[model samples]
Target: MTSVVTSETRFVRSGDVDIAYQVVGQGERDIVVGIGWVSHLELLWELPETVHFLRRLQSCGRLILHDARGTGLSDRPARPATIDDLAEDLVAVLDAVGSERAVILGWVDKAAGAIALAARHPERVEALVLGEALATTVARDDHPEGLDPAVIENLAAAVEQGSWGTGALLPAIAPSVAHDPRVAAWWRRWERMSATPNMAAGMLRTLLDLDVRALLPAVTAPTLVLHRSENMLVPSAAVRRLAHDLPDGRLVELPGADLAAFFGDTDALLDEVEEFLTGTRTGADAGRAVLTMLVTDVVGSTALAAELGDHRWNELLDFHHREVRAALARHGGSEIDTAGDGFLAVFALPSRALACAREARERLAAGGLTIRAGLHSAEVVHLGAGVRGLGVHVAARVAASAGPGEIRATGTVADLVAGARAEFEELGEATLSGVPGLCRLTRLVDARGDA
Candidate 1:
């Protein structure tokens, strides 16, 4: 079992104000967490969900949590918050912690600050992760999902009227758990202690007119955007625009409405982040759940090795590697390993894995090689290298049982993608080696027949 990381609360001087920051774990890499508004360095540990999130982030690297100026234990700045102030504060915190370069993770409207920092100081940031980020707070001519002008004005007025705190905001931010009295009280207290009502109002007014869309193109770091499917605070459409506007950005729409990442379906959200940051999924929380697995085997490897000399065979293998990697990229699959001439990979959705398998088979055939692939969607343990459990064994057996130039999958995958641009032919139940009972297998057929 991995030990829990201990975080130390400290303060760093940025400009005229002191910024409160915390550093957890001792991993070589650095991941700076700048959730921006409403934070208290000591009080944040009171919430179990947030504590879990920080610990998980520490598992990836040395997690750096900070309360930006005008919020939490940090000193209030002299003037209203601007993009440059937030960016400069971020740099100061990084310098204080001795982090030369780090991955920046930001949430909601505050994410723009991190985005701006990455755009302006590319040398200080390695990558970026934005959750439910908003480029603009008010509705623009192109983005209709942003908050209405009337609503934004009303929000500024309400904050000025001392109507700021989780008691008034938790329902809108995390409706899934807003009804729970205990949850509400905890968040309310945290929000109240974060900042004075007047300070909160000034911050809200500053953000109302802020827009960072122009900085999207200037950001050179790789980025990932995670948005909730039914999020009300930040519309899913806005999240889509953020992903599209930013260069080298990938969007993942998780299932939930909670603007707070520590709410519903938090594990799925964190698992994706961990994998993206560390190139491995240390799935400590997501146990044996529904997962998609893809197994591929190059047909007639012995014959090919004999036909082509040793050096030429190795070259052909390299070509095969390129072909499969390209296919995986097109289909959103992660290559697990290349065991001999066979490849093992996984995907968040079964359709993608099946598409990659069929595409790879066709592309390999063009290069005078035949491949047999199998896919299965089942409960499996996700480790760093590849998945474990009986499901993986069954998938490997299914691939070996497949005929040359064929793509096979389990019935579960067929059921999952029934309405997609694909179908499956049931091949009856077959007893797989090193498995319990007989499992039903199916061959994938794209809309255009015999994929």
Candidate 2:
């Protein structure tokens, strides 16, 4: 199916927050894509996985996409938004878009909003498609599939420590593509653009504590609950319980570890989603993707700039920039973006990322500059405009941990470049702040003791 092209973002008033929304199709029915995943509506099209999923749904009916209160392009409320607020916000979004009825499709974690709306305002919902559904999040003996409070708290801590909008949660959410530089880079951008770390943490805590099992039985519309057999974030049994509880719900177990509805066998997801919503299906494929990334930034650049003075600093910065760009091009690295004196770039191979980092540092150091570089290679979503998802966040954090003039990389990158001329020293395991789990870091060194 041909995906929807980029379009302008419009807004509707939902209390104080201006809920951003967009409509992509003019089919006979309406399907409101309830807020799910950390989102940015405009950037969603930039991802093929989401575009494919959305386009297939559009074929079934008109598709309504929106930023929930306090996230994406929507206005931030003075206080943290509640599940009730997000649910009602969906109602206002439907009304604003003139959607009297829609198949409310909710993604994981946000599934409660869809359930709440359907239960209280059944008149507004034609049906429901809940992927990665959960009636309650906190774990219990009977509901062992639910998220544990400690796990939730750890995630909250990671977010608080500046990991929320940077795809720091990628490994937990979608390990299948966790390190893909293309997918990871764009995901990192989404994190930064989605919401502040504090707001995200508060929102997560509120959502985690919310239990809406009582509301499930009240939903009058036909329902479909699709859960991955191996989704790490949300267990399959939890979705099974959800399916059994909803008055008119049916369950379909998909095969994959990816938690994102748009990643991993997206066609299967949209197949079930479209079939449930419109009683038909169009198998839209989310095609191939994988990427490797290396992010470099000058250590103490501000102090260096001050000491060097403006004129000399600008000249030096320009020289470093030109030299780095040349080194990257030489090593088949694509310039992803530049932030001040630093560069965020990509390579098709871990060796290239390593080589470019080494070459760039060597050239810069000779000119009296020092730099820090980080490398990691993994699966990613290669959106034509840009790459996105988890890999970039890990790489950025890895880069931040490096000492001056050192090139630090994850074991994943080092393993990938094994047998290449590059030499590596094990830095052992350390908790990558804002990232879940400890990581085995390694430093890439040349024989002369430079990155």
Best by lDDT: 1
lDDT by residue (tens digit), candidate 2, 27-106: 78898886574678888877666676676677787789998877889887756666788788998999988989888888
Query: lDDT per prediction?
Result: 0.81, 0.81
Per-candidate count of clashing residue pairs (backbone under 3 Å): 0, 16
> What TM-score would you give candidate 2 relative to the actual structure?
0.62
Candidate 1, residue 439: lDDT: 89
Candidate 1's residue-wise lDDT over 50-120, tens digit each? 66667677778887889988888889765567888889999999999999999999887568888989999
Clashes of 1: 0
